[model samples]
Target: MFWKSQRKYMIFLIKNKSEGEENLINGKMNVAIIGVGYWGKKIATEYSYLSKKDAQINLYAVCDVFDENLEFCKEKLEIPHQTKSLKEIFENDEIDAVHICTPSETHYEICKEALEHGKHVTVEKPMTLNSLEAIKLVDLAYQKKLVLSVGHIFRFDAAIEKAKSLLEQGWFGDVYWMKFTWTALMPPMVGRDIITDLAPHPFDILNFLTNDWPNKVTCVAKAHRKGQQEETAHITCEFPNNLLAHIEVSWLNPERKREVQIMGSERFTKIDCVTQKITGYENEKFFDMPNVRSNTIGDELSYFVNCVRQQTSNQVSVNKNNGLVGANVVKLLELTKKSMINQRTEPVQ
Candidate 1:
């Protein structure tokens, strides 16, 4: 129902655009979204909604392994094409792009196949289960001259973007260190742990804000439920210029939290990713930072559409959520997992 309402709002925008913003977008681009699970549905809805606003872009198809999901997309969102086979979507020449919202384990093969079929690809983070596969997908996207984006949503968050801009303006002078917390209580998911499931968001956000990658990682984790995956973990990363980042993730916390704090010699900033709010503190004074609040998922999809429309690798969009950046995040996660196993700090290889 919420997505349906969003679609209506988009239709209103489209009606308004016809009068004034009709020339905003240059060319038409067709996109398909594979996997209609929880996250996939959101991506598809945004694409469907935005298609109304940008006449050039269309939500060409939606794919899922389950029959019911396809039915829902067709009936609920009025998507033109709904399929149970990925090959069907891949075979459609009209689809210029695809968003991969499937499981982490399936990301590599799906993204590679999409790129091979001459489609720009956007896979949900972390890009792949490991760095090597991610590198391969990145290389394939480069070889085909297609845009490869990873769904690092926090990069599109208003608060995070604002904080990044402030840091670039040197508002927080001589940055020292930062901390990230993402915790919640939830049922265990097969083949998922705190590091792989929840850590990616904060990891990518830190990389986005710092404009640097971590060189070293130390991780400590525990599986409290005896036979299940690790439910809690702490990871410490060392970045260039002696900057440090600490992340804590858990599925056992009583109170949910998604926050990042960056401390510097001059001042400090606190960001709430969920609220899209940021506050700066200096000299015992706290001030709320102004930011333009926008639906990050919608913004991310729009960026992908623009990239697809641009076509050429030279003119392709580049940001912290690109394949290369996603690959780096995977590399760091791999190192963090290694550290957890060896009980020692590991250099990011």
Candidate 2:
């Protein structure tokens, strides 16, 4: 019921905000984007844009353990303040929020410390290794009255957002099984596997849309990618009301593909995330849903900061909406971990 009610509330809220076509995020927040790596750089760039053009936030500093990463961000963005320690942020009373773009393993420790110090935190996907850890972190943030946000970037996707709109308006009929595939080829195990790393976006977004967790999950994986970890997995999730979702993740494909096909009773919706486009198919009827595309990268960071500085309505709701997304991610990660461990020692034929 939490998901159902929140969807209605979200619909009402966004409709009101869109009427004026004015900026939804209006306040300036003092913020720092930690872990200056891949997505971390995106966070910094968004913050930098807000600082330079939009004035939606003040990019306080960039923090990272690797001196090279710190220097890279500092020189590339012309940012002056750089630190290897998170202590500087807590010591200063001025900073209000911290964006953590670190690895999955570090999310718990970093987010916990930040929240303990009363700073709002936005940790990247795969919120934690498991649900118990996620439950604890979210609970702590709530106890501290701090906003804990997860970087499930696709939740902010224009197409997915529109899908939510359509779903609310009863655009799609009784939902049927949906399929989501995300695949890419990379230099051998340069990093993590596909299921643990790549699958979170789709998994999180599915829960975000349906407002329900998978009652059961099963996964099958392979070790074709030359790593101890299984780089590809075919997984399925069963939710209430006969809603099923199939997720496939692989790092062994040639051309990378990221797409979702949400089948409903009346029609089917195929979304191409990379292209940011949604195509709909119905018997004797085929049409396209135009992009409600906003500057997700800019708007998302601004949204998190604006919520903190304004002290009003925000997107990341603990135990309300965003928490479930994190919980679902943890559940999926557990299955992935099990698959990885079993595959690593499967007696060779």
Top model by TM-score, which number? 1
Residues 166-230 of candidate 1: C-alpha lDDT, one tens digit per residue: 88999889989999999988877677888888888888888788766677899999988856689
Q: What TM-score fits each model?
A: 0.90, 0.84
lDDT of 2 by residue, 42-146 (tens): 888878888897565688888898998888878888776899888997666677788889888888888888877777778888888767788677556545556
Cα lDDT of candidate 1 equals 0.82
lDDT of 2 at 184: 83
Candidate 2 Cα outliers beyond 4 Å, as residue runs: 1-28, 54-56, 310-324, 336-349
In model 2, the Cα lDDT at residue 145 comes to 52
TM-score of 2: 0.84
Q: Candidate 1 at residue 148, lDDT? A: 83
Please report the candidate that would top lDDT against the real structure: 1
